[model samples]
Target: MAASSWPVKIYNSSSITTDSLKVPLHAFIRAYDAPTPSIVVRADTQVFLDSLAFQDDGKVLGFDLDHDGYDRLRNTEVRYLIDVYMPTRSLASLRAMGSGDVVVTPSALQNTSVVLTTAGSGTVFVSAPSIELANLNISVSGSGGFQWDVPATKVTSGVDLSVSGSGTLALSTTTLDAGSLKMAVAGSGKAYVGASSLVNVSSSVATSVAGSGQVNLYAAGTCRDHKVSISGSGDAFVSAMNCRDTSAVIAGSGSAYIQSTTTLATSVAGSGRIYVAGTVPGGLPGSYTPMASPPVTTYNAVPVPAYEPHKTKFGSHVSTGTSWTRDNATLIGVLVAVLIVLLVAFGVYRCRKSGRACFRSKTERPVGYARKTSTENQAPSMA
Candidate 1:
């Protein structure tokens, strides 16, 4: 059969599926969103190739080459470049399985799900300047790269992005207002969620970096929770503006740096380092001990207050009371006393619960003794 004789197939359906495609060298394929679902295959010149075939079974349309003759053209030279076009509707699910570079542009896809996978070294680019979709999934196993540039307004549900076998994945967006956003890297691959990639999420985000892979996430907005695990020699860097809860587990020599509005629940089993910052309202775990540091204040240079003169009703000049200074000495004293009492109580509670002394130095006075002496002194004053 001649390659030029390959028929163009069109379907009046809501979805499209294609078998595994193995495009010969110098051939290109492009798929985009359209008003209807259609497929077109065009070649520069006629060439005899009995492996090509196209089928449309009412609901699903597929195009592929026969395995027997496809293998025979593995080393054959191609003088013509064949172009394949598969345009689908926004309500359709376009599932493409191949090892070729796929480019998806803005407003080109509003499908329920857009799945693209490649087992070879073929890059994938999905850019949505405007348009929202339910799901977007892309995976690459070879040394190829995947880049997704979309805004939060363009993704209504979630995104699952993954790269393996030394492939790289990059997701860049202004905000991601989805239920969840997941990115994973394995087998020496690298994944990056840029500074403003996910500014806001409704549910949670989970990331995994294993097998010498590296994952970097920065400037994430408010979310319900976040979980990240790093194994092997992989490293993960996460920084968020705000979140309800966060956790990280490092089991290998990898390191993780996380900064969020709340403290993180972390576990470090190997030589890895976990750096966490922000208010820890929930406090650290029982097995975790934090080093205390004194608070530092910064003073700015400013002029002292000056009061302007004002005339009273009696025709006498008087200075206007424009500013007043508050006396917070008593408030400070009370706050300090309360803080000390709370600390002593917490120490005693821990000692009693664990059945062990919670003091670090033997020369220091016990919390109970200090509380007793303070109580006795205050009791005398009260009397």
Candidate 2:
């Protein structure tokens, strides 16, 4: 079943044929053609190891799970660096033998097994440009899906090659995934390479985003969970900092543009027409993205509004039937003195029912006039 892309090199050292192989411990080491034995990893099962003097293609470096050869490799970290005591998961070359490889999932490790021992000197002790983890020589690119690449001889982790995926493509010590690849999770998944993402500096790439989720993109065969998309045209240069999304969906349609450090909850649906230059903080709700078709045609402007102070916190108070508090100016002066005493009692009851006598608020007085005149006349007479 031949179908290996990108700089090809299945387990170099010249393709392997069994030279210095000792896979000791209880040694099962199946997969010569598959029946399930040589530490079976199933699917495209392979078994070959005879790198003509370990051309570095054939690697076997410093393994120290506290020595004793990792107690004969059962499973540690993640395995299959390459069968027997396993450890040599090949992406074809460019490797670093972490010598603790294992990959025998017959069913969540059912009947779980591990028994391998080795006797060297048959030729296999090569290391070039390695930086710990046993041996180092690198080159790897693999994918079951989500766009994949990178493979062209130069691996060594017990002996070049290793990649098992349901999702999440990895291998630390400086990783550079090349093109547009995507991944989901569960075996630690993630891969996407739109925007012409490339990295090739001899091959030692890493400067953060070293691990932990998110590679969701929607297009050219979609991808999901905790998204990472780029559509239509692509122009990206995202740096990276504090991101913890269990499943935060960030969508972009066609003209894709995303900055970073974003947060929002509940209802947020955009149907186009959202153009912001920057700085619009304080609260943020007021036509933030509600362009329901209007005289829309704005460019280079400033209009930010959305602030409700509530005049000193929680609607100040001013009832008056007995008492509330905050006296907003004595409740407008007792509602303007009860509207001027109800307009002087309705104008003295409409001047005593229209008979008219509401002069000084109801004028009607002449009863003592006569008595005053009589008293004046009498006094003159007596004198």
Winner by TM-score: 1
lDDT, candidates in the order shown: 0.50, 0.22
Would you estimate the TM-scores of all the predictions? Answer: 0.60, 0.19
lDDT of 1 by residue, 173-223 (tens): 676666677878766767766535555778888878766777666555667
Worst 10 residues of 1 by lDDT: 374-383
lDDT of model number 1: 0.50
Q: Pick the candidate with the highest lDDT.
A: 1
lDDT of 2 by residue, 169-259 (tens): 2222223322112222221123332222222222221111111222222111111112222211111111111112111111111111111
Off by over 4 Å in 2: 1-169, 175-183, 186-227, 230-383
Tell me the TM-score of model 2. 0.19
